[model samples]
Target: MNFTVVNKNICVDNIRMGDCSSASIFLVGDAETISLSAAFDTPPESLIVGPFVPLASP
Candidate 1:
């Protein structure tokens, strides 16, 4: 894979967020190469199925 990026003018005024998860990417500048990967494995014995419960307020 090859990429040629040319950025003349880039402006970011404001960025507002409430929550950011584990798989979140925030880029502001240019990049030549970027590769991201994720893997998750859950065994059958460790799987749990139950009702949903909201967390209490602090």
Candidate 2:
């Protein structure tokens, strides 16, 4: 494919994140092409299904 992008101005104030476990992107400008892929392969014997525990904040 072919395209054109003309970005004049972009402003980002703040981006707060706690936890992330996959592919992510934060683009503020033009891009011709973008590709993202994520894969998780866990063994059957190594999987843990336990109780939910919240993380203690500082």
Candidate 3:
């Protein structure tokens, strides 16, 4: 999985893995490219993660 910040805002919180809110809002699991938008007055940052490749287990 890969992570990318699409925007920046003071109001926006720091993005990290295992957090569903941001990931669920942006990712749909089947897109080559995606974009994000902020709905609130403060410009919330956008994030994208996908194109995941599982590693081989030993």
Candidate 4:
């Protein structure tokens, strides 16, 4: 799954592993696309983003 920020037009893949004792999952994906789209409204100018490789899910 991925968290895509629309305003910034940026996305990075994410994979969350399951713990031995847990049955419930954390975030499957950034369901709230609207909020996520707005999260990068004020990114720092000095920040340099990158192309990242996501970890494989088990």
Q: Who wins the lDDT comparison? A: 1
lDDT of each: 0.71, 0.67, 0.50, 0.51
Give the best candidate by TM-score.
Answer: 1
Sort by TM-score, top down from the best = 1, 2, 4, 3
lDDT at position 26, candidate 2: 64
Q: How many steric overlaps does candidate 4 have?
A: 0
lDDT by residue for model 2 (1-58), tens: 7766676888889867675433456666677779877565987798787885655444
TM-score for model 1?
Answer: 0.45
Candidate 4 has what TM-score? 0.22
Give the runs in model 3 whose Cα sits over 4 Å from its true position: 1-19, 22-29, 42-58
Worst 10 residues of 3 by lDDT: 20-29
Question: What does candidate 4's lDDT look like per residue over 1-58, in tens digits?
Answer: 8665655454658755544332333553455433322345565996777875454447
RMSD of each: 5.0, 5.0, 18.1, 14.6
Measured with C-alpha atoms, the lDDT of residue 30 in candidate 4 is: 51
Could you tell me the C-alpha RMSD of candidate 3 in Å?
A: 18.1
lDDT of 4 at 26: 56
Q: State the local distance difference test value for candidate 1.
A: 0.71
- Global Cα lDDT for candidate 4: 0.51
Candidate 1 clashing pairs? none
